[model samples]
Target: MSGVAPGASAKGTAARTANESAPVDDAEVVRDSRPARRGPGGPMGGMGMPTEKPLDMRGTLRRLLGDMREHRLELAVSVLLGVASVVLAVVGPKILGNATNIVFAAVISREIPAGITQEQAIEGLRAQGQDRLADMLTQVTFTPGEGLDTHALAVTLGWALLVYLGAWLFGWLQARLTAIVVQHTMFRMRARVEDKLTRVPLSYVDRQSRGDVLSRVTNDVDNLSMTLNQTLSQLVTSVLTVVGVLVMMFWISPLLAVIALVTVPLTVGVTSMIAKRSQPQFIRQWRTTGELNGHIEEIYTGHALVKVFGQTDTAQRVFDERNDELYNSSFRAQFISGTIQPAMAFIANLNYVVVAVVGGLRVASGQMSLGDVQAFIQYSRQFTQPITQIASMMNMLQSGAASAERVYGLLDAEEQEPDPEPAVRLDEVAGRVEFADVDFSYDPRNPLIEGLSLVAEPGQTVAIVGPTGAGKTTLVNLIMRFYEVQAGAITLDGVDTRAMTRADLRGSVGMVLQDAWLFEGTIEQNIVYPIATSPGAPVTPEQRERMLRAAQATHVDSFVRSLPEGYETVITGEGGSLSTGERQLVTIARAFVADPPILILDEATSSVDTRTEVLVQKAMNALRVGRTSFVIAHRLSTITGADVIVVMEHGSIVEQGSHEELLAAGGAYARLYASQFAAAAIED
Candidate 1:
């Protein structure tokens, strides 16, 4: 049996990967390989953790948001909540300033002589030549003996607390809603990618990096989901906070507001520059991660072969190289993105310093009250808080976007040709398969098969024997339409196969691949898979009876009955606990139950022992009754018994006839036969 190799798929274009690419017949199993942290709280909680601008940042963002359009309602509500939250947060500082003014004014008011009118006190201070002091006192609002209106102060402080609490509530709600939106969007995105995989052509898949495709599906999707959730929640609020706080700052004192605003442009420029440096690294990190995953998956899946061939050290060395590459890129991306937060903090401090010094001067000049100055200072900090958050979020967004673009590339990949309209039906008795002047190629520059014509008449067994890369599997690939023919037509029962839907054409044929592939399921399920997959597979009272008969016929019943579960035995990972010969028998049983008019066996007996081969050969004989069978044979016994033996060399038919007729001709088939028997003689 041909074993799975990395980059071979059990099915055509399953993410364009396979655990089974083999030179045994040049046919591969199209296998689709579908293959977190926090920190710091309580004692000063939470500073937690791309962009050389993504190659197509705007396009990626637009597409991502478009995918999220279905959740617009939730997003809209979240945005509204974010805006309301900002409003409350912005007003909180102003309200607390009022409370501070109340207490400070009451304290100042008590210092004035008791029972003296406010104007008289101011005049007395002016008379004493304390004009500046008198002028400052005029701005204070308090009655004599007020002495810090504890009740009023308590009321003002309560309002401030309510505003702050309200802000938190809205923000929490906004975050919750945004989480829902992001999760659903991610859900749809994942589905789209999975669906896209099935439609991806094998040619496209093979040409693309398997590791990269895997990363897009796994790592990139996850990064996008995470970044979107975290970024979206705060993104709206942060932006609105910047806008709202700016308005409040300007209202409190335009001069100080302008100074605070100056830091914004500088912050943006710094973030942009840092992002440009980091983005490419983030992309590289993710890309390298995919490459590592691909390599690991390739080696690990085929580990038995690796060990058998003693290439473990080689595999490990390759892994180390990729692992090291991943580390360097990840470190650079993290290191560069990491600098954003601290740099933003520094800029915020500078802005705070500038706004503080100027506001203090305004307060001293009596142009602004201590309360107004306090509010402006608070607003200045609030303004930079959101800007800094946005700056930090940019790193995350860029990383996610890089992943997003990768995913989009997969989704945007050219899909397979759609099944034909008005498809021809093939539910007839006769099975005459013909390849008429068929021309095909894996690469246009290198033609593998040119002007090849062949036919398998009804109930005839045609055995194809050839050297490796002699276009044996490639011919089968064309007939099966795994890879389309470049020129000429393939027909079944006088009807062009292309005119028939792929499903219908394939349904009319049964294939026993070299790998004898089976999934994790009950033995009964495995045996019936081919039939079960067909829409017309009869599910009658005799379905079980047919399965039992097929199992018994294939010698599968003998061993299966020995097991406790019989047909109910569960096999995992390509027939767990079953011998390779047994797996081959299971596939034969599958084809037996399918009972298609045409049977294509790729070295079906290669896995069975000599003794078992006799029984399997008998079972195959029974299964082939009245069926047009094409065998890609590897043994003399298989080729000599065929009604027709076609000798192939370098993509052309060198000789074709029955064993006796070809042996009499003494051409390519004779040489092939002589070589095979000679090898057997030497072994003897």
Candidate 2:
């Protein structure tokens, strides 16, 4: 029902009217917001793009590789292909050099020294110990008068064809191996993330921004996959290529090889410098991206508030500023990263010129053959190619390292202490709960509850009432073992809760939170979620009937019946399609379906209207039969019928007795009841 504000509409109208009156000013306003490019090959486009922050890259890669290690065969195959690719790429130039030399020698012998017979030339070449006789005799040239040697040319063509096939085959294998490693790694990482999210203390989530967590699960993992699948594989190939080329270069000419190797340290130095500087930027960029997503989510979720305040322009401006910051950060990261390619290429070309000039002199001075010079030049080129690639892939390495660090950061987080021993499942648990001298605090510096003590006998309905932030929610959290108490023990039927497995403890206690989150699925799915928690549970007709009765008791069945799909009706995420009251009823029905021995209803009907509250109360009463129930209620009237009402203040029990006794005490409970009832009476 929410829409844009009237003030925003008026402002927009005024702007339009002004623009109509003077279009020139409006046009200038638009132009200022757009990025400007100054000259040809300006820094704005390709040069100054911000480098990606390194945080996400390291974190993401570490997480991905950790998972990738799970599929050893795929990773092993990927590595093997990578090594083979490097070897083949290095071998290509050598083969080409040999072919070019054979052709050159044949031409020089027959034509350069005129009237040199083919037979005399062959004998002279062998006498000079330049015995390329076998290769030269078999070689064929593409001359204007003579047609191509269909046989010798075919041999050359066949070798060339094989090289091409090897390249393609290795390339294909590298791609497949990289894909499998990335896919399986991401799958495992996703599962681990989800599992950790569920098991961690709720307080941990409370301390973090939801957007940040969501970003880790989505953007961070995706970036990891990209870096791993694309960058990591190439990085491996580049390293092997560099090694292969270096070895070939040494074999060709050790002196020229040393000259080529001189550029190695400089290239590595520059690459390392850029990588070090760019990592932080990539981390910052991803952080900003997470912040931007959070802002967008906040705006959309609170669209009604935005309209109410008539602050659409203000919000939009804020969003634009954040978005621009991201763009600038990204630009800087990418610019630095992109520079690596051209920088390495420049150094490589410099090396190439040095190798060519020095080798040519050696050949002309009779110190080396033309064939040796040619081969040296080819090896030099090959050497630089991988160096350039490695320099380029350094950016990817940075990105992957960043992602790996982030993933490891999460993995390194200390989980809550696991239960000391395996749990023993009891066929039936008496619903008695006891809190003995319990002391707890969300933050150690600020204690919420100190020396709190309480007990609920089996089949008793105990209600807790207190002002906001008086440790009401903390009590529920402790009961569920979401947070361990700093001192004292919480027991169920005289057995310490901590002694039992968290899963077993939680499975025995059913909770209906104030805000219920339903996933994007059918109504039936939500009800059946409890039983499916086990590995082998089946959804039978009787289970469905029980769930339906539970819903009907809470009056949710009526709404389901009115819907187009009844029990099969699909709900949007977080139950957005359902009304708040309906969502509450659904949660109540879910708890009923769970049918645990101990029930905790934390503000179960606080947000519902009178009719819905009454319906929920009835359903709760039915469900509470013969079970220990802890009800934390804001509305005093709802808990008036409870067997005991315990008043709390600042984490301590102030009063406890039957509601009637507390009302007669004319203390905190009486004052709370009077204030609320007085407000309702005034409205009436």
Candidate 3:
């Protein structure tokens, strides 16, 4: 969620233009890489961002295999089934060839029933200048008074049917097991990526393109799932089919086997050449997809301001540009990878032709039986078939590898520092927060805060005020430990914050920022937030009571009761159903429900209207009566009654005291108050 409302930056720009005094609220922002035409895409860090490349495909694949180690047993079974299926499939053609041999031998022997020997018939054919027919007859076994052996042929055909049946059964089983293994592996991969998201530092997250990160998680992982499905299911089976067919071919006839092997080098060469060209395109296709997603996300989220600025046409044109890039890259990748299968098929057909002619000559010379020649021809077809199937898998494999590389890049990203071992725990937090000798900078080359020291005693309200980019919000961020200190320590109840797990530390605090968040859910559900969303967990009576009490205190109950659904009325995350002031009120109510020991409000009322701001001030006054509260406000009037008002300039505390005392001293705080009220006076 943005820390500022839509158009807040524009408001900031206007404020700057008018008074030359707009506070730089530099926190994290969703970025667009391209130069801005009018709105979001404008001049963000300058120029088009460079796309990512897959530097080490082999290492990435190895890491992917490591993730699948848990499912190795199922994968092993799948591979064995694939092998069995291919072996049975290869043997089926050979078995059917036997029936052909039996029928031929029986037909030749029909002449025996006429009281003519096989030699006499063949010699008469040769004498009649039918040398080819006589030569073919020599390869067939002729038995006197024997016709075609129908019984033997029936048995041979039955065995062939059984062989094919086994092939189908094994293939189906392999497919099922492969699916299981792939789903399980994807499950683990997603889990790892999810965990990594939580462990990465805020700085790391801020520097990344949000759309790119999301694409890796959603699109890339989905693509990986499909790739694994194609690869795991067919790769082993195709390879084994080729090997088994080759063995059977050599067993039948070495010459024919050698002729079939000629296509191997050509197949390998074509596949390799195509793969090299397509791999980079596939990588670019996915990267461009991420950039497009990022652009859409950025534009869509800021669409409200886009319309306010009349930037719809510009936004659509930019979207078209991104979409066109994706389309071009996708087309090139598909077109290149698509050539492999047809090329392999052509090479295989060439080998098939050569084998058919040689096998026919061998049968005529009496060197090979007609049945053997038939089986060898079938073997040549099977040989190229497996090779073709494997070639067909190349596109999916490369696409999947590109997806894997991106996902693994996310998984391998640097994580946040580990919490200190033997951590110190606060048995009871009295909410005494302190910063000592703190030094920090978002960019180390340019220091923002140095030697900052402050203490918030129990139940004291400290209001931090500063000029734009003067580190007002940065102060509270440090207190929350969102950014770690470079040279000092921050303590909560006398224990270093670094010693506590982030969850534990964050659980003690409730923060309401300037830009409020309301998710897609009922008003009551959003107030309860994460507690309401946890799986299978019911909201407690106490939580419900807190929700009701807070809604009343923040004056949210008034508007809610006016609606037909009351608390049950659903609102989108965009807060379309509620006004800006109402949205801010809902987030304030959420803070009230958290009931944390410590509260940090970063310009929480900046987005509210005058009437709503009064109601919020009343609610905040009541909420902070006995809590250690740190309020960072740009408005001077809001902090007039604070127990301590700290005035800062260029990251250093210039003046700090009660409001009246600062005005009496005529220091930095006094001038700030005068300038703010003076601006108000001029407007009046």
Candidate 4:
């Protein structure tokens, strides 16, 4: 059968997209390459990114087999066992034919004419000096029965039974060994892909949706495992059985073997034709599955938006289009692959009839015996059985290869450049940060930051204010080493940030983003997560005390205490139970517990209510007392007390000074401040 089942196609597609909706062009599937696109909300935020193309099949399989090299010994053993099993099975028909010949000889030899006397048979046996047979014949004469050698017949049947049992035992051993090889190989392969994910560039990851990456790791790997488990043993056995049965057929009657060989070319031609026709359908099936998944993900996740905008019917129409495409492609693929078995069976049956007639003529002409003809016919059936099975398995093998190619594509993706050897390590960071003639851009053709220069003294708060798309968050990303600057350098305490390891640089900087994230964990665990996951020595009681102190300082402890379980209460579903302001406070407390020398607050209070914003602002002001901080906010009121406010428009800084000084200058900062003031006044 066809590997492209409707359910499997849909599931694989959904796994690939991971619930993000975006359009994928057909060209992307062929080229299998594209620059990563940063969607709204950051690199992983958008749904429906383009699907990656599968790598060439030859390379994928070669790499896959290379991975199996470590288990080569086990695979070899499995192969040997499988070959032995098939050989035993192939010999069974010949053994049975031998018994048939023995029975026929006894029947023909024991037949006596009615006019013949029993004494005559005994006298003939005696003349031939067959005393034992002569004595048995005399007894049969008195009984007037046809004497057949029952003991010899039983002996032949017993041998045949033993051969079949041996085949079964060997087959079971082969299956056991094959399972071991497949499962172990898959385990290592999975671990390797997961490790590769960590080493790949964030830029590459940002460009793709979460679902695409997950599909490679989960669905593709699963397909490989399933295919290997099902196909490996069968492949070995089928090939061996075909060869063995062919050799046996030749032994019985070379003329009949020739007839069986004629079916080979026909079977192969039919299989190849069907496979070629089914391939494109399989590809389309997977592609449309991804489209359908993307559409479902987009609509389901944004269902509220769809209803609010009265676009539910439009969404339904789009879904129907994608679903219909998947249905059509799946139907065609299945229908084409489904033809292989019946077609092969027809050719096999015709070959069988031809062999039977020729063998019968040969037997009658005394060129072949009855038992040999019987064995040859049985061998013909056995020979075509594997051919039919292999034809049926062609579709599954193709699907498996396709899945492997996709997985290899991911594993072969560009990884992050290795960290510099013997990288500089910061011993004592004092929070003195500088940007020197920095140049950067998400897109090189459209520069976002050009020749930027700035310095923040130790323990000073620098506020960055700008309109949307002013590279505010981009600057913070560069500082945190999320993205590298195209030119110049950003230094912390006289050392270029690039010179230091990313882990060290980022560990020294803490951030509170506008959208606070809280994984499923207790409140205290979230606050002390940095220490918990740190690679250094285990956290001590003193560190635990400090975490609690940070939570209290940020005023998160007060509300946490009101909950039924206080600090131990579990936060589930990304902390949906918490108010927006409460979540922000918790994130702020997490940062405070980290005790980094530098801090970044990217509109940290943008999602809070006015009353909560005032309280959060007070807590933030206190947190900024003795640390270098970058505050990127649209609200002018939040940054009024900043030591210096840098006003940015487009990609360049237009002005920089204290809030009061900027207003007095009546430049970009003044216009921004006035605009916000007017809006706030209207709201009041």
Per residue, candidate 1 scores C-alpha lDDT tens digits across 1-684 of: 111211232243232112112232433211122111111111111111122234677789999889988888888899999999999999998998888789778878888867877788888889999887777677667776658888988998899889989999999999999888888889988999988886766666654555556767898899999999889878888889988998898788788888887887899899999998898888777767777777776786689999999999998988888789789989999999989999999999998888778877777667888888788888888888888899999889888888888788778777878888778786683889998998876545445678999999999999988776677766666676777777899989899888887667777777776676777788887777655643234344566788899999888899899999887888987678998888888888888888888888777887679887887788788778889988887786865788888888777888899999998998888888788778455453
Local distance difference test, each candidate: 0.77, 0.70, 0.78, 0.75
The order by descending TM-score is 3, 1, 4, 2
C-alpha RMSD by candidate, in order: 7.5, 11.7, 5.0, 8.2
Off by over 4 Å in 2: 1-80, 109-150, 309-314, 359-375, 533-540, 679-684
- In terms of TM-score, how similar is model 1 to the real structure? 0.87
By summed lDDT, the worst window of 10 consecutive residues in model 2 runs over 37-46
Tens digits of per-residue lDDT for model 3 on 1-684? 112222232232222222211223322122222122210122121125454454466777787778888888888888889988998999998887888888888877775455778888888889989888788888776665679778888999999999999999999999999988889889888898988887776555555567788888999999999988877778888889889998999999998899889889989999989988888888878877877878788787888899999999998988888788789989999999999988988898899889989999998887788988899889888888878888878888888888888888778677778877777777777999988989877655457788988888888999998777677767766675656889888999888899887667777777777776666677887787635545223567876787899899888899999999998788875686798888888877887777778888778788788898998888788778778899988888988999899887777777889999999999988888888777454453
lDDT per residue (tens digit) for residues 1-684 in model 4: 011111222232222222111223322332234444222112222324443343355676677789889988988898889888898899999888877766655654556444556677667767988765564443221312344567776987898899899999999999998889889999998998988976775556555545446656777789889988888889889999999998898888888998899989999999989998887676556555545554565576568799999999998887777678779878988899989999999999999899989987776555776677788888898899999999988777766776776677678788866777788997888999999999986555456689999999989999998876666766776786656788999999989988888778877877777766676777777777666754223456876797789888888888888998987778876575788898888888878877788988878898899998987897787677789999988899999999989988766888999988999999999999888767455453
Which portions of model 1 miss their true places by more than 4 Å?
A: 1-54, 113-117, 127-135, 427-430, 531-546, 679-684
List TM-score per model, in order: 0.87, 0.82, 0.90, 0.83
Better of 1 and 2 by TM-score: 1
Show the lowest summed lDDT stretch of 10 residues, model 3: 38-47
Q: Which is better, 1 or 3, measured by lDDT?
A: 3
Q: Please, what are the lDDT tens digits per residue for candidate 2 over residues 605-636?
A: 87889988888888788878888999989898
Specify the highest-TM-score model's number.
3
Model 3: residues with Cα > 4 Å off, grouped in runs = 1-55, 110-131, 138-145, 533-542, 680-684
Q: Which ten residues in a row have the lowest lDDT in candidate 4?
A: 1-10
State model 3's lDDT: 0.78
